[model samples]
Target: MSDSASVDIAGLAPAVKAALLEVLIHGELPRAEIARRLNLSRASLTRITRTLVDAGLLAEGGTRLMAQTGRPSEMLILQPQARHVLGIKLTGDVLYATVTDLSATAVASRELRLPSPDPADVVAEIAGVAREFSAEYPDIVAVGIAIAGRVRQDRAGAVVEVSAFLDWTDVPLGAMVTEATGLPCSVENDVRALTVTEHWFGAGTGLDDMALITVGVGIGCGLVVNGRLVEGAHARAGQLSHLIVDDAGPYCDLGHRGCATSMLVNSAIVGAYRVAGVDYEGVVAAARAGDAVARAIFADAGRALGVLVASVANLTDPQKIVLTGDGIAVVELAGDAMRAEIARRLDTEAVDVDIDVRLWDFSEWARAGAGLAIRDMLS
Candidate 1:
């Protein structure tokens, strides 16, 4: 293959590369249309697309007839399979993975249940998975791992600041994974990784401003402002769990009474009923079966969530707010109350804001990991 076939796209200017990928993402477009949308001159567009085309990332497709002039302009196409990326989601006991082409299409996936959360043991398992995958898909260039909690990352490696789910802190996760797998690795907060996928491929796509709300074991939010994910000064910009919703509500070990986390998190709900080992799914079923107490619990939780979401809407004014995670069904069960609370709490001018609810699984979170790799490629 020619050198251009393996060009280092990371060297391109941000605007030039972004414009090219924008066209690639939106699909084959005529030169004029691409330039007009990107606010670039024909000459500038030609220069940028030329570099991409030469790098085997973009190609010229058949001409498109212009509506007004009846003239033909060649269209540009993205070579999605030019490269591949791997994504993994690391839970305390399970490791879920997926391989995706440049377009973020999953070609294969895997799941591994871990007997231990030891960093070395988990890294070894991941290396084994990467090796098995490499035999069939050699183009895989990078891997992304998503875990719950605070993560600090740089080109050299990543450190898991704290992970309550895994009971890990200050772990050099990225370096360990990279040394074992012989591939570049990125570590990101699970919810933030999901937001990355949503921004590029899911409900949040094409929007410059949006927020993703996840309600599972905990409540988390991810913000995208001006087409970029906001990590904040402390890398905790979207920590919505602590947002106080009711001063007299239940309290967690953190001692925050009536906070969204205390009122809406899985543990809070489970603790409320004092059902021995009852999972969130059971709570959903009970509420759906006309259990008044269960319904009331969900109603309160929903109201808490609604207040948290409305606070985000009022402050950020995002174009869309996406809700997902294990607690989504509970939110649905509490639909009327949730909606009413949201409508009542939101500023009158923001009442028309769009709220989207989606269901996501571990594989989807893994896909978000793949999205991190794709992000590196695009940036």
Candidate 2:
């Protein structure tokens, strides 16, 4: 185990830990700024920061000149490389992994295609990856695994209540991985894990309220409210992909007609073309070439997504909404229609909210797992 893995963070006072985290999140800040942001008096801030500096968790960096006086104040900065963590995203047939520093910056990554989704098989594969990363970066303290499912976790450990894609249920995923790799493991819902990454280090940074909507083989959402990821009672909070957008649209596997899953997912779009006797590639090519039929199909999907986005905005009133996933290309193709529908559906209060569109790959999700590891270590 690394020194960080054995460090006694519990020895620090809670207020001191909070102060250290504030600096970790916002980067180097003057002592006065830290005190103000943390709502602490100068004496309190000094005590907390000094303890963190003594613990080697924080470093006093370059001084900043005060505007009111000619005096300078030293800035408190977090030591990003103080510890490293591993994050793994387990899909149906692939495990994407990344090694990140305390700041959640990926310094190394790898992918392994699973031969099967059996619990033991996946566990062995995860152990292999952990060993590889451990050999290269002995500083890695713990591992985070993100799976697409209903994850249940408590003081005992984490279990996958259900993994719809992998057809898993009631599996002790955290225990399995930990035993296999000889390291602590944290398992989380993939979307929720991804949300944690965003809340801590990605686009959702500095915003207390934001939503991430992913479009792909399945529609997924992650929500952060009041500066915390909302993992509901059963840890299945943001399941909006099945929200019905059109009553007459295609039926989802869950049996919802015209739900976001039925209209916006890649499988749904490709299935629509198959039903219409058109090749999938031909449909995308035609859509790009302005074919009326292909364009209409994408436009309809976009409109459904627009309704979904607007509904989320009205309900949560988040500061920002991120649109991303493997199927986001469809949204870009039909951007005009989607924007129009969003404008029409949004309440006056939500009309001006920022909706950022980003294209993402599996590596980002892996990084989310790493972010969760960091959070687990700190917490």
Candidate 3:
């Protein structure tokens, strides 16, 4: 991250290349503005922009008026179709995969119903998907996979450990991937990968610090700080789903009670409604219908979630908080209660960051994995 060292032509530079790349990928930045933000020089910036443009890496555009002088600025935009990356999200029963060119634009995607939970079987099937995707696109050179557990990392931030939710532990996922797909592979935690994708190109883009909370059959949290995803002590720091919010909360196999997932997940909400003797069309419908039991269930879930969000904001003071997942439907069920509790405990002044809670496509999760691979290749 220092300037004196030489930058690898293959890897993105710390400042100049990174700044330009961000503008291109995210779109619409002026030359003067890019120079000011990245502490760059206009002449040097033009040279870089020209090179990127000539290489079909960035698209250069017109100028915007600034003050009295209509200072001309080179606008940088991504050549999304220049390169390609492939990603897959592995679940117990199925896998969703996509191939994205350099700009993080999805070119082709696949959804495969898997055979067994055996890691080897899953890996082979995934390799076949990659092979097919690559054969179609021909520009793909990197592959990534997103799993749902801790990825062991060393002190230097090298990822060395992973145990996907399928009960596979200490697996050499990245290595196996490269060997099978014959491309550089980067394995990431599904949530963290999703967070990275969001931070750079999705909802969380242009924000320095943020959190993405996901709700589904399971609950997951991904944290980003100072433009880097935090992979604490073996990449398991953001495990807020297991945090106990209820002393008498329901049982979790992970040995915690009253956790966010235990009380707020899809299964939990459905189970709560079932216990109350109501059939369901999702938690959102149940709550909208004024089912007191459903309302109570979601409210409880919201309260617990509020506590979790408060903990993150209180601890990190990130610029924004993004709530997303396969189960925003449930959050919609008790939106008022969840927002109320979040407002109650959230430090409005100390944590001045805005909260952006929105629903996203499920495939975005898999694409995030591809984004990580693209990030790795670009770096």
Please write out the lDDT profile of model 1 over residues 1-379, one tens digit for every residue: 3576457655678767887678646767788788777898878888988888877788889898978668888888888877778899988899999998877788999998986988888888889889998888877788988899899976679899998878898999999988898787888998888898888878887899999999888888999999999999999898788889988898877888888888788888878867887777787788889988889999998898889788999999999999998778766788778878889999987756698989766588888899887776677
Q: What's model 3's TM-score? A: 0.86
**lDDT (10s digit) by residue, model 3, range 1-379:** 2221122323544554676566745577777777777777877777777666655566777776655347656566766676678888877778999888766778778798888877788889888888787666766767877777766533333243545557776667677767787777777788888888888777787777898888776788888899788878745768787777678888766667777767877777777667554444555676787868778888888887777777788888888888888777656666677767767777767755477877767687789888888776556
Model 1: pairs clashing at backbone N, Cα or C within 3 Å: none
lDDT for every model? Answer: 0.84, 0.84, 0.73
Whichever of 2 and 3 has more lDDT, that candidate is 2
Output the worst ten-in-a-row residue range by lDDT, candidate 1.
Answer: 1-10
| lDDT at 21, model 1 | 72
Candidate 3 differs from the real structure by a C-alpha RMSD in angstroms, to one decimal, of: 4.8
Tens digit per residue, CA lDDT, model 2, 1-379:
5444456553557788778778778888788888777799988888888778766678989999978557798888898877788999998899999999988999999998998999999999989988888787877778999988888885667999999878999999899888888778999988888888887888887899999988877888898889888878866788888888899998998888888888888877787766566655567778898878778889989998888888888889999998887778777789888888889988876557688888777798899899998787667
The worst-scoring run of ten residues by lDDT in candidate 2 lies at 2-11
Once superposed on the true structure, which residue ranges of model 1 sit more than 4 Å away at CA?
1-5, 8-16, 37-44, 66-71
